[model samples]
Target: MSRFYEIDPTPENYWRAIILFGRNTASYKFALAKALLELHGNGKSQVKLEELAVPYAKHLAQHIKQQPKQITSKRSSFLEQITAYNQGQLDHDGLIQQTTRLGFNNVIDAFHKVHGNDVGSRFFIDQRRSHGGIELTDNLNHLLEQLSAEDLAGEVEARWRLVEEAWANNLSRQLMLVEYEEHDQQLIGIHSQRRISLTSARPALNGYQKGRCFYCYREISILYGSDTPADVDHFFPHKLKRCDDGKPIDGVANLVLACTDCNRGAQGKFDQIPALPLLERLHTRNEYLISSHHPLRETLIAQTGASREKRQDYLQDAYNCATVFTGSWQKWQPRAEGVAVF
Candidate 1:
């Protein structure tokens, strides 16, 4: 069973699992995703590959112009043609022809696979055999109704940017160190003293949290201008920054998304150490983040410890020190009916 679907079983969460956990050897998946979102339900159940080529090629072309290395490979005939099109060697018509022929070769097959296993829901069915194109599934339609296409598109964009930036900089494994800047609440990538400001910590994290508040497990929106925006909360209060002995208290490992009610409401966890159970939950959440791809995985591993046992000790020690400084800690009691989404 797909763990992501087990979390919420909603079409939106399934789509997010594809975006957050699917492998990215190239940016083709993302480009194809943007194309699908652009063309999904505009009065058509299916789109011919040639028709799909237009937006597919356009998105890839735009990204090629912005960032050159769209694929991990040094050479891809598909990308080469796109580059030629960008350089004026290939005209728009010729570009579309090449995209029709070369694109959709792998992405269509791999889009629904997360970590090599099929997701529980099908967003689109491959119909190239019978229809010479792809057919939009009811799952896609349902997801569109649940969340605006614009919001989903933004998520694809955010995930794409993070992947491409990390690839462009060759930041893999421990080479990349990410730090949290509390002032702007954005993650910063540090390597060789050069700091690269990455995406907002909210969207980068909300998917992993499955769009629910960490404390209450209530559904939360990562959207910036939404009526009730989720807060990028520090699990161990920010003031306890001094207790970690030099480890960054603002690191990604300690950050969790909290709904406004659980964050600043009358029962908010303002400056108090979370109850013991919440600490264990934080450990589980951090491990989940570590299992994910580069930058975040590396960042958390760096901030916490290299091994699981060490990580457990690190959090426990930090929690212990936090309890001491606070003098007396209150156990945060979440509402009785709150669900544990993670």
Candidate 2:
């Protein structure tokens, strides 16, 4: 398996990597994702740019209503056209016409690039030169075999929301600090005295881990409808929260998604200090979070350390403290062997 799909080499993982790990210069990738899922549902293999523009522009328009700034760039004509359409300044036909001409400049070529590398699988073929739009590939159809269209689409939306919310909140200023709520297992954005519930910790964090349990690397779901939704686990056991001089154990750096069997089953690592190797994985995961654009990057930097070496020492110190409290053990092993997806 390639590094991108190391958890399980499936069509679904490839698709998830595209949505989860692709760089978001603008939210157009997400708009294209929403359009692809909608078009796929209608059973169209070949779609013209005009047909693609309708859903693509519509998704952008909807998002502009919620959050005006969709791109990191200072200005975007395509987004402005959508904003105009929402304001009744541009008609539907005008919006679609402009979208077909301006909206798909880069997303079609960049969709499959994950972490600066193109994934081995292709979800759509860009036929804009001769065919006018795109040709949905069999890989996309096989993805439906692995996961339902609704769930896959929800993952895209969740990731889009997470990034846009962080963008809107200006990362450098620390406008809002993200905090974990243990009672509900939700991440809250604190601004001054007001507390806003950002999103459920599962969907926000699931994509970075590539839809697998952090320990076992088994396939997991953030969908509430799934038979076994993964658990939002504390990487260091929650019981060790008091040992770190009151440093919050529930921060994004210390929380990971885990399968129920590995989290609380008979052979679970509940309240136990995980083997030392897992601490290195936690460090890697946190660095990945820092590399991403989400406010969780700021939260992790604040909770752990600003630099990589400091963060490494932070985890090392925490592990030493936890080992003193709860005796160290290397007995726990994941139910399956899987490579690191990140």
Best by TM-score: 1
- lDDT over C-alpha atoms for residue 187 of model 2: 81
Off by over 4 Å in 2: 1-14, 88-94, 113-119, 172-176, 191-196, 326-334, 337-342
Q: How well does candidate 1 match the true structure in TM-score terms?
A: 0.89
Q: What do the candidate models score in CA lDDT, each in turn?
A: 0.82, 0.81
- Per-residue CA lDDT of model 1 for 211-244, tens digit only, reads 6788888877888788767898988887676655
In model 1, state the lDDT of residue 127.
92
- Model 2 over residues 1-342: C-alpha lDDT tens digits? 234477566777778767767887889999998898889888989999999999899888988899898999999888888999999999999999999999999889998888787787898999999899899999988888766676667677777876787777775565566777978988887766778777778877776676678998877888886876789898888768777656668677788999888899898878877777788888988886776566777778888888999999989888888878767644356666455555
Residue 114 C-alpha lDDT in model 2: 81
Question: For model 1, what is the error of residue 145's alpha carbon versus the real structure, in angstroms, after optimal superposition?
Answer: 2.9
